[model samples]
Target: MTPSRELWVVLETLHDVTYFTPEARAANESAGLRGFWRGYVATRAAPLGAAGLGLVTAVFHNFAPSFLARSLPSVWEKVSPERALAARLEGAVAALRAHLPEPPARANELLRRAMDGLCWDGRPLGAANAVLPWPDEPTAALWHAATALREHRGDGHVAVLVSEGVSGLEAHVLRDAADGSRELIMPNRGWTDEQWTDAERNLWARGLLDGGGLTDEGNRLREHIEHRTDALATYDLTEAEFAELDGQLRPAARVLVPGAVPHPNPVGTPRP
Candidate 1:
């Protein structure tokens, strides 16, 4: 399929997911979806051409500070398959880099390192061990937090720690309002300290934290998360290929924009 058509299909897929994922639609509600979407179409108009950017632009119109943080990874989950997620993510990087007049290869290299740290040698749900009530939630939550950190600071370990507010994320999720605290969203239930601790330790081991804050590896991971998010947003898919591409891009796409179903809690909520 042509690049223009691919972008149109991607937009449609994003719209379907947006409506399908209630949280995603609700989040867009606050952002004035229609107006925000118009801006993106206007900006990417040249690349979008006759078909325009379509739903992809509307779904991702807001472009808020934390928008991509929670969206890309989730989107990837819906689009890609378990086995090919990593390679698809690499494809996203390639597509985005091509779009840039002078791409930063160093940054891309750093992104791969970050991805390695998250994917557990390229395995799906390879992040921190299962700690939340639901089994599948931790990966997405952890990724969202990591994405936030990467966007705040451009993959600099020190910058990630200082600006990202590691403790704050835990506390925010847990509803404790304390720094250095972590909470696992219980989907339908509530929070649990046991699960939080496990997540904390796992994140620490994965270099999401250190004695002071985010470790060097954590910073690298954050860089990869941010880069991937941008790539997904910049990437496109054709109408016919959307379903086919979805299976391959699931993991990284979701990593790029986490807009999936009721993500399970890794700590305590009863599993279905």
Candidate 2:
């Protein structure tokens, strides 16, 4: 199996591993136990046509155009169901929220933890993109600070991280300052040392930043626990329910599997 596309994992709710093509599903059926399990998971879950398509669009909008050009078309061919989900991320998030059987408390915590992880991981579209009270203010300040640092000295560290991927907040700041340029390594964004300090301090204060990094510690916590919590909360899957799911679920199994074909799982799937 080839290395699976990141988009496929993100777009898990759309289709089964064979991309749900008649031929693929048939191949999956022939794969015996593995295919049976895959089909079982897909059949048990509800379809997410609109939501899946909406998510694809959201990804295209958020990612760099060139990157999307290389990735999206291929992903469309492999997992076309997800194309529609692109238009529905926001609405899908809402609908999934309502339909999920988890308790309100768990839902909130899971979301927070997930966002925190994104912030800490320093990737574009991570927790930093999450909406808070003030929008333009913090981001603008951070951008100014980063730019100043870049011009004054050359802290390509931040630039590298942003290029490698920083929180969506970082991307937005870079974009705003660079006038829509996606060149994260460029020193085109603007800011001062003080402003950068302020932004870092703000994130630190928010429990989303620490140890000189942007992501919160909570985000990297074990997915099993988070998934269990979410399953318990939204899906009304209790601890036992989670336990059952855990038994059947493989955590990054494909990564460890030899000869596993690289492709997206069905939509609504979480990273495992």
Clashes of each: 47, 46
Whole-structure CA lDDT of model 2: 0.30
TM-score of each: 0.23, 0.26
Please give the CA lDDT of all the candidate structures.
Answer: 0.32, 0.30
RMSD of 2: 18.6
RMSD in Å for candidate 1, one decimal? 19.2
For model 1, the run of ten residues with the poorest summed lDDT = 123-132
Leading candidate by lDDT = 1
lDDT of 2 by residue, 20-129 (tens): 23333443334321343223322211122212323433422232233223333343333333322222222223222232322222223322332333222322222222
In candidate 2, what residue range of length 10 has the lowest lDDT sum? 146-155
Q: Over 4 Å off in model 2, which ranges?
A: 1-56, 59-62, 70-211, 215-233, 251-258, 261-272
* Cα lDDT tens digits for candidate 1, 180-262: 22333322122245555664676666566666666676667555544443442322233444444434333333332333322
In Å, residue 199's CA in model 1 sits off its true spot by 1.6
